[model samples]
Target: MADPTTATPASGKPGHRRRRVRDLRAMPGFTTTAWITIVTLYLPILVLVAFSFNENRSVVLWTGFSLDWYAKALENDGIRNAAWVSVKVALFATVISTIVATMAALATTRTKKFAGQGLVFGIINQPLMIPEIVTAIATLSLFALVKKITGLSGIGYLMLAHAAFCIPFAYMPIRARLETMTLTLEQAAADLYAPPLKVFTLVTLPLLGPGIVAGAMLAFVVSLDDVIITLMIAGPGETTLPIYILGAIRRGITPEINAVSTILVAVSVLLVILLFVVQRRMQR
Candidate 1:
């Protein structure tokens, strides 16, 4: 009898070896780092949301938990006025930015080739790449020039500046969506003798709906939160929420500011949840 350990297949047969696959994704260090990063970044946001309900006026201390801050925030006239202004700016800026960005995206993506496309994209995105202070100064200077030349002043200039600032934020996602989307469906519609307006309304616009909505949301949020540019470009009685909050802080840290912050935080949270639910439903 042959020894068990020494047993072998027939001489002409080849030896078989199994290849073990390694999952790069399952690496322990990588997962640990990712979890750490997520926690580090989100912990402050979670704390902010949690403490917004704190009864204490102090941001650092949690004396007790109550909903009084929300009530006070609702009743505060200054906060309400600032919030209203911010809402108007965000709404107008979002609409104008969406329209402009959509046109820019369509122009860049649909045209086979266009002169100065790169230059145009660079100019549109300059605000994002440059420092806020630089943009604020430039906007202020331009506002001065416009006022000197036109001898006109109103909220319209503020709206235009906010829209311009928001254009890059709106353009990025819309342009990306356009690039990834196929043109065959649009071409097919045109071949079927569909009018240009009808083709855009029925085919292109429908497919681009989500991107447009997302871009609008982003532009609105940016406009709502902007401080420096708004401070520079805003006219009389055009104080936004962030600027109000800053002024409140400079004067003193009052329960009013805390109250206002809490309310804003709550609204932001609700918006996020609503967006998530809408996205999930759309996917389904």
Candidate 2:
């Protein structure tokens, strides 16, 4: 044997080291940027949640423990009315958006070479990709023109504006579900002598139930939290919770706003949990 070790290539050791480095690079690890972003975004929310229970009026000092702010927020007629209006608007917008989005999802996913299908989907999803401020301003301008001609004055303007913004939020999840769902069950239902209505009622609707519920919840949350579009369209008496919160904060940030914010956050968390349960049941 003429020295077996001499047959190994000189580049082998460095090549191994380079491969190890490449593998390390390919596997993602938390970086400085991610940490910075987490701190920047969540720190304020942490502070708000923490100080909501503070006894002092000023947020800077936590004088003692108290639930007085929550009580006061509940008692404020202005806040109560604004919250009720927001709930109403959000519910209406959620219903309308969910219906339109579900139909759009069905049409886009089920059909082939339909005229205007592309146009319809594009228009329905445009709000999501476009700047929200642009949509708000355009909606306000159009509504202003309509009001001048028709003399219309009601919460209808706010409802329409919220629905417009909520459509894309509702469409995306339902479309995703439709695209991923297997059609074999529907086909089998047809083969079994089931009518189209029966198949849809017994098979398709139940399968799509989780998706519809999730999408509606998303739309409702978006509508509830919307401030820019609501502020642009809502009339004086039709002040939604977001607009009221903005007005309150402009005066000064108070524990009441914190209490309200906590409640909103709690609602969103509960809905998300409910969605998870529904989705799990559907999968089973």
Candidate 3:
């Protein structure tokens, strides 16, 4: 009888030691590179968070843990006003961006590709490719002309600017989701003679919910943390949190800034987790 353990193929001496699949993280350089990258990116944030509660006023010196900085940050009128402005801008931008992105995604993804399809998509994503400073400068000049001609001014303009800038960020995920969706369900619904509105409202919107939520949250975060555009367009009296933080840091980094930074980081982390959870549930 032939020995099963010694089985071989033509010209193949018993196979070399059966190779096992290796996890990418277990590879020679991957783990080291990952650790180095993580530390480089996040060590400053970790240090800032840790020192937010420092008893000492010196940001670099950690005396002991205390919540005085947090209390002070909450009581600071500048911080509060800036935070409120950020909230308003972020909320308004998120709503407007999500709506515009959804319609754009639907138009691009659901329709037949034709002339100018590439142009349309390129325009939609132009903000991402152009230098942010260039966009900021261009927006400032346009707003300046508009102000000169129309006498328009206020936080509303800032919201509109943020919405316009955030549209591309919101469009990508929604478009990706729409592209991956199977047309079978929508076609099936139409075959039953259901109206377009009902078919979309009942069949398409539900499946697109996760992407919508993710896009809205992403837009909100981007708007909230925006500095260059907001700095260019915001009035002397108006400042969002990011602008406020940047100005403060230029003068000096303080514990109050650290406390606010920690809170912003925590909020961002929570939103990211929520997005992950929604996506996971959709997958299941």
- For lDDT, the strongest prediction is 3
Comparison by TM-score, 1 against 3, better one = 3
RMSD to truth, every model: 6.8, 5.5, 4.2
**What lDDT tens digits, residue by residue, belong to model 2 across residues 1-284?**
34333345674676565566556656465577788899999898888988999999989987998899999999999999998999999999999999998988888897776888779878888888788888888999999999999998899989988887898989887887888789999999999999999998999888888889889989998999898888888888899887998999999888999998888878877887887887676566
Q: Please give the CA lDDT of all the candidate structures.
A: 0.81, 0.87, 0.89
Candidate 1 segments whose C-alpha is farther than 4 A from its true place? 1-36, 58-60, 269-284
Model 3, position 283, has a per-residue lDDT of 73
Clashes of 3: 0
Please provide, for model 3 over 33-105, each residue's C-alpha lDDT reduced to its tens digit, 9 standing for 90 to 100: 9899999999999999999989999977778989999999999999999999899999999999999999999
lDDT by residue (1-284, candidate 1, tens digit) is 33322244442322231111134226668988999999999897777766767888787888898888778878878888889999998899999999999999999998887788789989989989999989898988999998999999988888888999999988987887788789999999999999999999999999887778778877887888898998877877889898888888899866667667666666666766765665454455
TM per model? Answer: 0.82, 0.86, 0.89
**By TM-score, how accurate is candidate 2?**
0.86
Could you tell me the TM-score of candidate 1? Answer: 0.82
Q: Model 3 scores what on Cα lDDT?
A: 0.89
Looking at candidate 3, what is the lDDT of residue 276? 86
Collision pairs in model 1: none
By summed lDDT, the worst window of 10 consecutive residues in model 2 runs over 1-10
The clash numbers for all candidates, in the given order, read: 0, 0, 0
Model 1 whole-model lDDT (C-alpha atoms): 0.81
